[model samples]
Target: MKKFYIKTFGCQMNVNDSEKMAGILRSLGYEKTDLPEEADLIIVNTCSVRAKPDNKAYSFIGNLKKIKKEKPETIIAVGGCVPQKEKESILRFKHVDLVFGTFNFMKIGELIKRAKKERVVEILNSKIPEEDKVPLIDSYLENPYVAYVTVQRGCNRFCSYCIVPFTRGRERSVKPELVLKEVKRLAERGVKEVHLLGQNVDFYNYEGIDLADLLYMVSEVEGIERIRFTTSHPCGFNRKIVEAMKNIEKVCPYVHLPPQSGSTKILERMNRGYTREEYTEKVMMLKEEIPKVALSGDFIVGFPGETTKDFEETLSLVETCVFDQGFVFEYSPRPFTKASNFKDDVPKEEKNRRLQELQNLLRVQAEEKNKKRLGCIEEVLVEGKSPKGKELSGRTKDNKLVVFDGSEELVGKFVEIEITETSPFFLKGKLLQKVKV
Candidate 1:
């Protein structure tokens, strides 16, 4: 079998794209290979979200240049947000055989065929792919219990500081029936958890049906014991979704709401639509509805117009909300984004200070949150062995990572674990009992 190696970067959305590409390659008799040197085809599924990841992609491609020189027959391809954004510049490296955009992954065979004759760069302008056009990958990294299904493609809200609107195009959703069919098929294959992915998942609407409706349908599928979606905007996170989390037993009580900044002025500068007060109100409402729900959020420090007071507001929000998980990032202006042209006035030193300060506060809050679960029991879906050690890793219903001793047979099963120890990132657990398979 012809072996293919792929390195994926960025979020779950990128992972889904890489899997889809793998499915297409598998159709052409290419088996997945861990080693890039042993592969006939090499692909880098990239992300252009921040400066660091963008630089990482560039550095990786630079290293791959040597690999191509030694093995001239190995075809190299780069696809996803980075290629979609960089376009012609990505082909500047002579080693890059083919480049495709986020929406054109299914055409891998044709792109490779064209690349053999000359450099081929195909970037689609549209957002969504035709239904059934993108192949479904049933397997991932030997984890058979969890899956990521793209309910929608692209974003409608073009936050001034973001490049997703340009690279991913507009919001286009998959049909609810199609999504349900995939979940059912996954259920039959023993999948227990399915996370519906999107640029802004709360915006998923096919006709009148929305994400809440989709979640209800997916939870009804035979083998799906846990349900989830991610990266929500406060605009569409209404009472329906809150109700879904409350009413549906299978739906996970975890939400990722990215309140970029807590200052209305900075939020306005970012063009994030909802006000700070509005976002806070929404969070409060959700908490009132689902008392035990755990929140994970995103924060950006040192926006173009952020003042000391604005930074304080962000810190205050973090303190007030006490997110179980906080993803903090220093703002890096991306190309073609409005903030890039708006003069990045936040000093490098100041930005670094703000990031560290925010992280320090969040760390204490996260530790406090984890410590609360010390004697409590939580149901966890056993994922697999941790890369760091021989301990088996699993996640709670609210998305808390727990490590404990277990066999490979427990990888895909749901287990109830008592929190024996707690840390900021994960918990040390003791084996309690196995739940439903």
Candidate 2:
């Protein structure tokens, strides 16, 4: 009858980790609660990718101190990237009963037991063996029809501005058999879509089996109607992966390649291993191979020593690529990253200005591209109801969000929709027909 609450921050990887932890807690007879103060245990799953999220995690953990004092028996745990990087320093909050790291979620039961007795901190500094990594748990999926299965962990590419390699350790791929096994199990449980996750998902390789092979293998699983993978590094993404996406019927034609910056000089300074020309070449390859492919990219506006010319080059890249979606961020140095050592010469106001300009350009491009989809019929997998309205919502194969009128019976099924209205962010559609699988 005990209740537990988990507050998660940052990306899909962190969300998956939190789900695994929730599953572990459920197995220990703990029910999840939305209210932190009402729970017997409260967990703050943190992220340190950006200064905003990193500071937010601290603020959240600080506020939990009051709940800990109000309920003396409440157990407080802190886990994820922040704890992985900060280690025992997270315990400075005093009320934190247990602190675990990115690689230590499998030991949650043991840690919680020890925390009940005394304070405990467990941050594994080395690679975790395959048997010890977090397993796919069906119980904690927020969406029954969609799931995120992490096929790889950590990052070998230590980009100058990233904290992932420091917090998550080196790249380690889950065995292909293990990944396929998890995929089959998810399909059997009625999951229609699976998103393979990693810091750099295209870098996934177990033995000689690569991400492209994994895609083909996953497609063979019956009932798995769609497969998507994310956060690919352009340097590691290859033609074979693009071919897999083209040949496999189930593999969604969407790629989230983080270009980071468009200027080759800025890219070199950031330790991103590809030139702007090379990155665009890859983008062109994806577009040529999968004509319907929806391209998503990440851009950092103001890195150390970035100039007006460098910023202009980035704007040109965005303009040329015309990404269907673009996530623009102002560069903020992180602890242990090489970029932190360089002088942060860009003024805050200038960084903000560049960010706004880049964002405006991206928005214009997105709206222009989305407007082209009007009246087109899109195959959408109904994930659930829209958060903003009464309409049912789902995503197309290329990851475009479509909302339309539908019954609850349509939640787990695929349907064809005629794009009626479009915005930079999502598409409003009319349900045309139910797709017979």
Candidate 3:
């Protein structure tokens, strides 16, 4: 039997995909290992969202090159967004035995069988592959309490600054019955939390079923205590999703709405298909519908034609929205994005300065908002031990991380935690007792 090590990078989708790949490899007698040195095959599941992740992929590949030299029989394969974007470039490294795209993993068992016979480079992903209905949260989950199910695949948005439409292709949703079947299996396995994943989750629609219907269906599954969905687009956020969050008791009161730029003009340039006021209107509606709802968003500073005034608009919007937590990005041109054709006029130094300023403001807001949770009691699902040890970590219903003293027996159970200390990023809490949901 051969051993394999997979270095997964980027979002939960990539994580799910990597886990699925491992499951596929199991039938071929390939066992997963922790160390690259101990494995006969090393797979680098990549990300290409920003410049940092893009560079990190090559840097890690370079390090792996040395390992390949020492042991020539070791096979190094690269998959995911980076390879989907730069298919031919990955083969430049002589040590790399295979290069595949995001949707090509279903054929990996066949690919690996062929690779053992000869060197192969497969980067052919021109169409959206048929999606597997089974949930990926099982077998490969780091935490038994939680799981991620991919309900949809690809994107059709074609936002000017985004490469998702090119790399992932058009959006298509999984059947609601299939989604419910997977959730039912997870419930049977004692999984308490289920997170439905997609590029733009709100746009999910299939056979008279949408995201809201899927959420309601999953909530009906026995032993399923919570449901969450992520990476929703501001343009597609409609009343159905808001109603789901309000009526469905198991649905978490959290939404990650990515408003690329706060300035309407910059947003228009990005082809986001929504205005600043429109985005805030949706956020406001969600809050009004569910008062305790935690709002998080995304921002991109120093876009192609952004001016100082435009950046100030973003800052002003941030102050107005007061996001519970948000992410700020410095624009980087992607190969198939419309921004690539325009001159990247924003000076790198200026972009960095703006990014720092935006992040600083968001940090202050996050700390101030977190302070409100200091005396509040939150229900958190115990996931696993903390990285520093002697402490256990879990997440609140709204997706806030809370750490406390706990035993391994409490790993998959829910406990009421009194917020003792509040940091900008997470909360320190004390568990009262485990509760039955």
Q: Best lDDT goes to which candidate?
A: 2
For each candidate in turn, the TM-score is 0.97, 0.97, 0.96
Between which residue pairs do clashes occur in model 2? none
Reference-based lDDT, residue 185, model 2: 86
> Which scores greater on lDDT, model 1 or model 2?
2
Q: How high a TM-score does candidate 1 get?
A: 0.97
Instruction: Give the lowest summed-lDDT range of ten residues in model 2.
Output: 130-139
Q: In model 3, what are the clashing residue pairs, if there are any? A: none
Residue-level lDDT of model 2, residues 230-326, one tens digit each, is 8799988999999999999999989999888889999999999999999999998889888879999988988998999999999998877779998
Which lDDT tens digits does candidate 3 get at residues 188-267? 87899999999999988897788888888888888999999988998778988999889999999999998878899999
* Superposed Cα deviation of residue 337, candidate 3 (Å): 1.2
On the 0 to 100 scale, the lDDT of residue 347 in model 2 is 93
Model 1 over residues 1-437: C-alpha lDDT tens digits?
98899998898889887877787778778898899989889999889889888889878887898889999988999998998988766887889988888888777778987887887889988546665455555444346788888898888788898999888888888888889888888888888999999888999999899999988888889889999898788887899999988999999999999898989999999999988889999999989999888898888999898999999999988877778888889999999998899878989999999999998888888899999999888888999887696899989999999999988788899888999999999999898899877
